[model samples]
Target: MSLLVCAYVFVPETNTTVAINEQPKAPFNNLFGFESWRQTVWDSPILRKHNCTLLNSLSSQDIYAGDAVLLQLQNELEVIKEHIDQITDELNLHKESFAFRIDNAFEAIRIAQKVTNGIVYIG
Candidate 1:
């Protein structure tokens, strides 16, 4: 089975305390899939530095605020771009595909940051 990593922009209605509603009204986009490449993301040194782990990283159960996590992901994107060669070599990932995935993830986070009370949902 393939486990897809997806990101969404969620804006809670005013007066609502829930982070994620039972049925999310906002639309979401798929960023990447954690299939054969799961290990690459799970073991990323940059992600690790940001406290992302296999179990918690990008999962809906993540306790960190979405904006905070998205900020960390943005930082990771810069580092990944700077050390693309090394990261690809270390993770045995396709450079182009990995770059594309990271870029899409960043874009999703960027959009999420624009809305009031917006948060990212990754699963």
Candidate 2:
């Protein structure tokens, strides 16, 4: 990423113990110590312990490294999505066949009903 250098920034710092530790504005900022913050975050053992961590510090730009990885992952996801669609299509086809069978049964019952009604004439 880019360096966020803001000159004349009003960063609040209120040390309850010592006024000497105060920066400029009100409220405490024991959490935002400069060198300690750098060491804790940029120089932590979680990152610094790995040999690959040094490469991250070297790069000033090209912050969106995950884009290429995500693009590849999206392609894979699309393939899986297509497979799921195919499976769903097959399932729906089976359901349609079952529905057609039911329709055939209902048609047979309707034809039998008409036949029975034809013979039961009271006129």
Q: Which candidate achieves the best TM-score against the true structure? A: 1
Which residue runs does candidate 2 get wrong by more than 4 Å? 1-93, 117-123
Q: What is the TM-score of each predicted model, taking all chains together?
A: 0.61, 0.20
Model 2 gets an lDDT of 0.27
Could you give candidate 2's per-residue lDDT for residues 62-116 as a string of tens digits? Answer: 1111224323323432333344444335433344433332233223222223321
- Candidate 1 per-residue lDDT, tens place, 1-123, comes to 344333344435553333322222234344554654444564556556544453235433432236666676566667667777876787777998777666655555665566665554444
Please give the range of 10 consecutive residues that has the lowest summed lDDT in model 1.
16-25
Per-residue lDDT of 81 in model 2: 37
Clashing pairs in 1: none
Model 1 local distance difference test score: 0.53
